[model samples]
Target: MVDNSQGHSAYSEDALLVSRMNVKPGGKQAHMRDGWFMRDGVKVIQQMVYPPDHPEFPNEPKGMKAVLAECGLSQQRLRGKCKKCESDSLACCYKRILELQADFQEQKSLMQEVIESMGHLSIFLLKFTAS
Candidate 1:
């Protein structure tokens, strides 16, 4: 039990569980802290910060250059492909990469803006109150 201005209250397992925000794939990347459950080939729940020193995993390529590199079809490989399907395959892969890049950029920019704006706001508020 702990007390301050407010009266003391009991703490229990339920309280601990309720405060946790589980960040699983369906709930992944939420801008809040959550506890996650782990299971086969997936994390059922994920915490806000990844576990300490977590190893990075492979992510799907999201740019034209990255896709071409992953598919082993860089400029040289494209040249080696049969003429009939050469342009078609390249166009398809390029389109996919552009789509991925668009999505990734949208998400990345939004995250950056949110963090910066919030940090600035916090600083301003602190300075304002201090004066």
Candidate 2:
């Protein structure tokens, strides 16, 4: 006979089992707050919490250097140029190169198709002339 008047069963063991079932198998859960993770004894930031101009992360040359590195451009070759100018020039040049490559591939495919058609036509003509 269990007491049902208090909404909870008379067996406290059932409540404990239910609570434990909700918990993950990990040793401890990491709590996230404001883009930070508290794991074990360490407090870690999930992202760049500081602004670019912050002393820990300088804004000027580092950004340009990162951009140049990503674009595979040499900083020494573009020493005097502004970041925007260099980036724009690189973007335009890359776009032109990509367009040229696409055009070359299309022309190559078209040439292959033409060559195959010519071979078929020549074979047909040779057979017709022999007969």
Cα-based TM-score, every candidate: 0.19, 0.17
**Candidate 2 TM-score, true structure as reference:** 0.17
* Lowest lDDT 10-residue stretch of candidate 2: 14-23
lDDT by residue (1-131, candidate 1, tens digit) is 11232212223222212112221212322233233332465544433343445454222112233333433433432221232443344343333332333222232222234445676421222112345
Q: Model 1: how far is 52 from its true place, Å?
A: 29
- Quickly count the clashes in candidate 2: 0
**Model 1 misplaced regions, further than 4 Å:** 1-63, 71-91, 101-131
Clashes per model (N, Cα, C within 3 A):
7, 0
- Candidate 2 regions exceeding 4 Å error are 1-62, 82-131
**Which consecutive 10 residues in model 1 have the weakest lDDT in total?**
16-25
lDDT score, candidate 1: 0.31
What is the C-alpha RMSD, rounded to one decimal, of candidate 2? 29.5
